[model samples]
Target: MSDYSIRLYVDSDYEVTRNLFRNGIIEHHNKAFHHALQRPHIWLPALVVLTLPALNLVSVTTSILVVLTAVAAIWFYCRYMYTSYVDYALSDDMLDISKYYLQRDGFCFWVAETRGGEVVGTIAALPSSDPGGEKHLELKRLSVATKHRGKGIAKVLCRTLIDFARRRGCEAVVLSTSLAQINATKMYEKLGFRQTHSFYPPGLLGQFLDFKIIAYRYDIPAL
Candidate 1:
């Protein structure tokens, strides 16, 4: 809806980004992140880059080198974020989303929304109902402070996820959402993550249904 800037996650941003990620997955939605959050190798380099904090005492020059190295590694990561965007932006497939939010000086992020264009925007559009709702892509997790909802950051993040997923080789995208996040539901529909008449419990649904939240499948096909 509005304008926003995107960047990679630097080593200095490890904890902030990680927490944002964890929260997005664990807090708002408890669904598996694109099959599994850790399954994607996209986040490992950033984790490896962050291990340098313990070696900070090795030397000032070494520390600076590590920081710079981490920044470059992070820049390379920025490329993935962009690719993921491309994958979902132009496809009829699922999406992978990873991102950060601005904190006092850094960022905190943890919400990924995926949609497939093949599906309709609401349950009425679906051909029929199911025992557990229609199936869809298990996008990634996402979270934002209640104080920051109406600002439309989530909308930007949803679009970012679609673009990112498209870049990652997806034709469209899908997700399992819930009513606990009514505002987010509206955002998803607004962005084309239509409901498809699916029913998602209002609790986190892990790979094996690990949490207590309901979820609905939202899909976004190629544009």
Candidate 2:
């Protein structure tokens, strides 16, 4: 794989970075759905419900309704999440690009580009939201184009964040990611980030997502 250059985000990179993030999410969602179809955990529940009618435990009409309800719930939940994510991103730094991230204190955004100047990835380091968390930095919006996987673009972005945090006197760099991002989880682990916490979306959404959200942190040594 050819090396990609990493640098601070520029005004011209706004659209491409947004596209990379959006497309990365869509790609992950598609891959997750395909994986779910093959997983026994997902299929087994549906299978049990379908077999109930044959066993006379549920009437045919009720069985059909049950199966359809389950399918609909999953579909609607995925759609809700997708819409919520896009809205959240659009309403924040991702939309304004400059005000929230560029002008904000202790927040830095970066873009990775090929030698030909095609932007392929992006990442950010932002100040922690916790009131007393001055030493902590939050890693946010890390993404690379689907076709660019296995090319070390993600590693470069991650390392850039780590180095940036170290230079900024950050005690640690943390991020929250979902289980659907298996490759990202692995990459973080390889980069020496430890699993520090797990979180859920809350209420019905949490139930649907099965509490897949997790947190990872990397401790930075003082120079």
**Residue clash pairs of candidate 2:** none
* Steric overlap count per candidate: 49, 0
Residue ranges of candidate 1 with Cα displaced over 4 Å: 1-4, 21-138, 197-223
> Deviation in angstroms for 28 in model 1?
6.2
Off by over 4 Å in 2: 30-45, 55-65
**Candidate 1 C-alpha lDDT tens digits along 162-211:** 55554544444555554334566777777766565444333332222221
Highest TM-score among the candidates is held by which one?
A: 2
Tens digit of lDDT per residue, candidate 2, span 10-36? 989988988887777655654444444
lDDT of each: 0.40, 0.81
User: What are the root-mean-square deviations of the candidates from the true structure over C-alphas?
Assistant: 17.9, 2.8
Please report the candidate that would top lDDT against the real structure. 2
